[model samples]
Target: MRKSFIYALLVGIMVAWGLNVTALKILVDHFAPVTLTALRIFTAGVVVLLFLWGSGQLRKVSWNEAKQIGVAALFSVVAHHFFLSVGLTRTTAANAGLILGLVPLVTSLLAMMFLRHRLTVFRLLGIASGFCGVVFVVANGDGGLGHLSVGDVYVFLAVLAQGISFIMIKKATVEARVMTGWMLVFGSVWLFVLSLVLEPGGVSSLKDGTPSLWMIFLASAVVATALGHMFYNQAVQHLGPAESAVFINLNPLFSLLGAYWFLDETITLGQLVGFLFIVAGVVLGSGGLDDMSARFRRAKVAAGGRKVGM
Candidate 1:
C-alpha cells in the first residue's frame, strides 16, 4: 500500500481507539469493569470469528497454537483489559491514553530482550525519555509518580502485559486474524470468571445498563477491538511493525481531543509536557523520525539526479 494511504488509515484507526477510551470511561460509570471487559471481549470475538469465516480464513487451531493463544489471552486480553478498565475508573481517559502511548517503547524493550533485537543508543535514550515522561505523570504528588494511585499502577502494568503479549504472539504459529479471535474467546472466558467472582452482579449489570452504555459497548467492541485490530494487523503486514507503529504516537493527541470533546476533560500542563516527551520518545525509539528523514533525503537525491540528467 502507498505510505500516504497507510498513514491515513492508521490515523482513522487510532482515532477510533482514542474515542473508545472515552467511551470506556462512560461505560465504567454504568457497568462494573470486569463486566464491561467480558462483554466487549465476547462481542469482539464473535465479530472476528464471523469476519474470518466470511473471508474463508477460519480454521481450527492446532493444540500447540491453542496453547500459545491461551498464553497470549492471559497477557494481552485478560490482564490488559482487567487493569485498563479498572484504571479508567480511577484516572482520566486522557491520562490513560497518554500512559498507554508508552506501549511502543515497552514493546521495543521486550523485543530487544526476548527476540534478541539489537538496541541502538538512540533507542535506549528514547526509552529512557519515555520512562521519564511516565515518571512525570506517575510521580506528580497530586496523583503523579511520587504519589502513585492504584489506578496508575494498574494501567502501567496493563501496558507491560500488552507489551509482553506482543512478543509472545510473534512466536505463535497462528495467523494474526485467527489468533485475535481465539485470544478474545479465551480471554472473555477468564474475564467472565473474574466478573462472577469479583464484580457484584456480573453479567446482570447489562440488564440495568443505560442504552447509551450498550451503544458504547457495541462501538468499543465492534469499532475499536474488532475493526481496529484488523486494520492494524493489516497495516503491520504491509508496512512492517516499525512503520505501522509510527501512527501510535498520535494516539495521545487523538485521545486528548476525544476526551475533551466528549467528556469535557481538561488537559493539564504536565500532561501536555508528558505527551511531548512520550511522542518524541516513541519517534526516536521506533526510528520513525529517522525513517522519514532517510526517505526525504532519498527523494531529494532522486529529484537532483533527474534534474542533472535532464
Candidate 2:
C-alpha cells in the first residue's frame, strides 16, 4: 500500500476514535464501564473473526505467536480498556482526550528504548508541537487545569499500556488482522473475568439497555474498535510505531470536535490554534516535510539534467 493511503486511513481511524470518546461517555451512563468494555471488545473481536474466516485469512497461530498475541492483548486491550473505561467515569471527556494525546510521546520513548528507533530532531520537534497543541486545547477549554482527578491517572495509565502494546505490535510476526482479532478476543476474555470479580451485576445491566444504547454500543464496537484498530495496526506495520503514533496528535482535535457536536461543548479560539500546531506536528513528526523536500530536490536535479541535454 502507498504511504499516502496509509496516512489517510490513519486519519480516518483517528476520527472514529475521537468520536468514540463521546460514544463511550454516553454508553458508560447506562452500563458498567468494565462490563461495557468487555462486551464492546468481544463484539468487535467477533466481527473481525467473521471477516477473517470469510476471507480465508483465519488460521491458527503457533505457540510462540500465541504468546506474543497474549502479551499484546494484555497491554493493548485488557489494561488499556480497563483504565480508559474506569477513567471516563471519573473525569471529563476533554481531560481524557488531552491525556490520551500523550500516546505518541510515550510510544516514541518506548520505541527508542525497546526497538532502538532513533529520535530524530524532526521527531522531537513534532512531539513537542503536538503536545503543546493538546495542552493549548485542554488548558483553554471550559475549566482549564481544574485540579487533577484520579480519572486522569487512569487515563494516563491507559496511554502507557497502549504505547507498550504498539511496541509489541510492531515486533509481532503475525499478520495485522490476525493479531488484532486474537488480541481483542483474548483481551475481552480477561476483561470479562475482571468484570465478574469487580462488577458482578454489570452483565445483567445490559438487559435493560434500550435500542439507542445498543446502537451506540454496536457503533463503538464495530466502527471504532474493530475497524479503527485493524487499520491502525496495519499502519503500524507499514510506518513503524513512532511515525504512525505521531498521527495520534490529531486525536485531541477530533475529540474537541466530537465533544462539541455530541456533548454541546464549546470550542475555543485557542483550540483552533492548537489544531494548526497539531497538523504541523504530524507533518514534521512523521517526516512528511522531509519526504516533500527530498522529492522536490530529486525533481529539480532531473530538470537540470534535462536542460543540459537540450
Candidate 3:
C-alpha cells in the first residue's frame, strides 16, 4: 500500500511535467520569443519565491548556493529558453517535439561518457530505440534536414543545453546547499536584463496588455513553471530520476497534441509510428538490459560466495 501510494504520486507529478509542454506552446502563440520568455521566467520566479517565503525556505539559501543558482540559471533557463523560444518561432512544434525527444538520449550519453555511470544493456537499448524513433519522426515529417537555419540550430542548442543542465544540476546539488527557487530567481534576473537591452518595453507593455492573455500567462507561470517544478521535485523524491525520466516521454506527446488541437496543426501517421519507436526505445534502453545485468551480477556474487565458503 505504501509503495502503491508512492507510485501514484510519481505518476501524477510526471504527468504534470509532461503536460507543461502544452502550456509552453500556448505561451509562444501569445507573444514574441524572448519577450514571452522574459514574462514567463520572471513570473515563475516570483511565484516560486513566494512559495519559498511562505514555507520558510527562503532564508536558508547561502551565498555559495546563490552562485550555483546563477550557473544553473544561465544554462537551464536563460540559454535554454532563449534558444528554444526563438527556435519554436521557426520550427513547427511537431518537429520540435520530435527533436526534443533526443534530450534523454543526450543525457544518457553524457552520463556514460562523462559521469562514468554504468551503461547497462538496458540503458543502451532504450537510448538506441528512442533514437530510432526520433529518426522516424524526422523522416516521417515534411521538412528537409538542411540544418542551415538559425532557428533550427538554436532549437538543437536548447535541447543540448538542457542535457548539460541536467548534468550540471546533479553536480551542483551535490556540492551546494541550494534552494530550488534560487535558480528561477536568478534566471528571471538574467532574462530580465536581456529583455531590458534587447526587448525594451516588451515585458513592460505586457502589464497593460489584454486581460485574457495576461491571465493565460499567469496560469503558465503558476501552473507550468512553479507548480510543474514543485510536482516534479515530489516525483523525484518518490520515483528517482531514472524512472521519472520516462515521464518526459509524454512531454512531446502533449506538446504536439496541443499544437494539433489548439494551434490547428496536423499529426501525420508517420509521426505516430515515429513516436512508438522512440517511446519503445526509451522503455527498452531505460531498464530491460539493466535488469538482465543485475541478475547476472547477483548470480556471479552468489557463485563467488559459495567458492569462498568452501
lDDT of each: 0.87, 0.83, 0.69
- What's each prediction's TM-score? 0.92, 0.84, 0.83
In angstroms, the error of model 3 at 292 is: 7.7
Candidate with better lDDT, 1 vs 2? 1
TM-score rank, highest first?
Answer: 1, 2, 3
Go through the candidates in order and give the clash count of each. Answer: 7, 0, 5
lDDT, candidate 3, 62-119, per-residue tens: 6776677788778888998888887877766776776676677677777777788777
List the pairs of residues colliding in candidate 3.
122-285, 122-289, 125-285, 126-285, 130-281
lDDT by residue (tens digit), candidate 1, 233-310: 999999988888988998888888888999998877788888888888888887666577779999999999999999
The residue ranges of model 3 lying beyond 4 angstroms of the native Cα positions read: 1-6, 146-152, 174-178, 204-209, 286-310
After TM-score superposition, what is the CA distance of residue 215 in candidate 3 from its true location, in Å?
2.8
CA shift at 10, candidate 2, in angstroms?
5.1
Best by TM-score: 1
Compared with the true structure, the alpha-carbon lDDT of candidate 1 equals 0.87
